[model samples]
Target: MNPSRRGLILGAGAASLAGPTLAQTDGLVLNGRFVQGGFAMGRAAPRAIVFVNGEALTTASAAGLFVVGFDRDAPPYVDIEVHAGNSVGGRVARRTLTVAPGSFPSTRINGLPQSTVEPSDPALLARIQQEIALKTEGFASRADADDFRSGFAWPLDAYRVTSRWGSQRVLNGTPARPHYGIDLAAPAGSPIRAPADGIVTFARPGMHFEGGLTLIDHGQGLITAYLHQSRIEVLPTQRVARGTIIGRVGATGRATGPHLCWRMKWRDRNCDPSLLIGQNAPENS
Candidate 1:
């Protein structure tokens, strides 16, 4: 890797992936959290084609920048490849990385309305399905901008973490899917800010599970979602900069208390939002 280029740094509390120190290549530099539910930013020769597991996930930016993410249930090892130049004097670099599994704890929450935990009403179930479909469209937004290069910040000035990413959740004595978002406990109506520059792809004031849901596309399939909001201030196609107030925290959805469920996604892969705090995007040499 080039000595002048820098990659993202994870927060102090983020779990670091354990692995052997693999040799770095000068042709392509990569860095960031490498564990399951983590993220990584990369830099390669300008116009170079990058691939993960033989599939071209993304092409490098004009400045040779790009990003990738690991899902919550990502496998133990990942394969990366970069190809540059043509048939004459071409350059290729390959790297195999060992990723660490997420250490999630079992969490049990009682006293919630049984309907919220496992809705039995056919009408309510249909509404939930519609809401999920809307969110799916929001996650599909992919703008050709580099707004993520500005990096991310905490959405709230101060809050307590009530639930972490990838936690095994048991609600109302029924085991549920692992939580994919970080739940920040804040007073109702607390201001929520945009974590990075991005264009709003979806914003609705009402949803069965995610009240006042909102999603922002930070370019190249990197999207962030805010759930259980008391108020939604932005609209679809709106552009917002970091620290811009976008909404207010609340318990309007299935939540038992006032809080914000913050989530991040790189394409379809879910990632840890807390890991991006205070991290800067990678730059070319």
Candidate 2:
């Protein structure tokens, strides 16, 4: 068979095992299907847990089984671990997996400086704790799933990318961590728009690390966050349309200059925002 035809057959075979199926002994790939089914130990009520690269994933149940999609831009060879949590406590109870590369388009990130912190200061630690809490809260239950799947657009126009997502950084010449969001270099007071239709979940001015921040729930556990804004034009619980002007760019909190940091999350799993925009999004809007 031709290479393209062989790949199509393989993809079809993988998709056929949609419901409870056998787990691959090797790795899972982004946008790829695999059979990951079994009973997990430790919970009195039997709660399912999934993790990718040590980060827990929020899974959705369907047809007597659970299914999950890897982040569209996840790195190659991610480890997937499953466990069950209960009222007693949590324990690791399943297999470890390695993820391979699939057919998703690759993204090239640019323009971020390397920086790091010891994370030793009490204040900084506390702030980190707070941010963690916010992320872990999950998406709003009322969010509609159809809205997010419809499509997305660029949230801003005429801006240069100051930082791209997934860039490993060295803070103070020491390796720190990877950047998780795409930052747009815009002057303070420049309009920042919404990428999709959603309801505002958070709108707070001047947080410990994020400066002014707004989080919009785009349904189906998908959320978009805007950080380091100089002004917030939306309110909590407010419904916003795609392309709505929700805020303005600014240097807020720990940032050194005015910029818009755009972030996307599926539950707690972070994904790159650039993958959702059209080719003409930056140039036309």
Candidate 3:
């Protein structure tokens, strides 16, 4: 059989078969947890085949365990398929996963008074829409996983972490969106840096929702956003090396205090920023 056709057939069968039963066949058993934009798998058969929502992922070695992430957000339930083939025979297995929404952290503002202003003021809403468009247009590219793995850097100087990625949040006794990025608490004038080498795409001050925002486009459809800044030091279309100072943290636009809300996106998929930073990693440019 042609390798591509064989792969498809194996994938289809794997999608319907149980891991253990497939193991009894010529294929290896595969198990994993699936979530929006990310997955974790273990004890896969050596040289096993893997597919997520019908998309094939590159496996680097014959190790039975692997992980995969996507550049798009997936709904709650996702399908996973796997197959393992050797000279003698192969097996296929399929499973379903229910992904939970990521949690965001709560940040307490020390000196701001409670505001009575309506959050839905027409002028504010329009400006927010414009900003979202700019951000969306800036990140609308598709790149494979290899493009992101080249190297990762901290976008800003390491400071005391005010909030962590994926922490649950409650605003004023009401549940709000989960915190998507790691927050670094620094002085209002503390300089903010880029996490990786990329081109500046969007740099604007006080549009509507975001007070001072800067966005960078890393090649292959990856982008980072810096929001609620007190100052923007870079201009749109400027090329920045990793760790370059682009702005300073501040309480701008709907914020209660001075802090930086650094966010990362792979196309439309929001991802955790902490995963890309490691100890003693070079502060690239």
Best by lDDT: 1
TM-scores, one per candidate: 0.88, 0.61, 0.60
Best by TM-score: 1
Across 62-173, the per-residue lDDT of candidate 3 in tens digits comes to 4444334432245765665666662224566555554444334465433332331235667756766777788677666432222233345665565677787656555555
* Candidate 3: segments with Cα more than 4 A from true spot: 1-52, 55-118, 141-147, 279-285
lDDT of 1 by residue, 164-262 (tens): 898999998999999999999999999999999999999998788888899998877889999999999999999999999999999987889999999
Q: Where does candidate 2 clash, by residue pair?
A: 27-98, 28-98, 28-99, 115-171, 116-171
* Pairwise TM-score winner, candidates 2 and 3: 2
Order the candidates by TM-score, highest first: 1, 2, 3
Q: Estimate candidate 2's alpha-carbon lDDT, on a 0 to 1 scale.
A: 0.55
lDDT of 2 by residue, 5-116 (tens): 1111113213222222223332221222321111111111124455555766543221112223345454433344545452124444343323333232224323333221
Residue 238's lDDT within candidate 2 is 91
Ranking by lDDT: 1, 3, 2
RMSD of 1: 5.4
Better of 1 and 2 by lDDT: 1
Error of 3 at 111 (Å): 7.5
Write down the lDDT of every candidate, Cα atoms only. Answer: 0.79, 0.55, 0.56
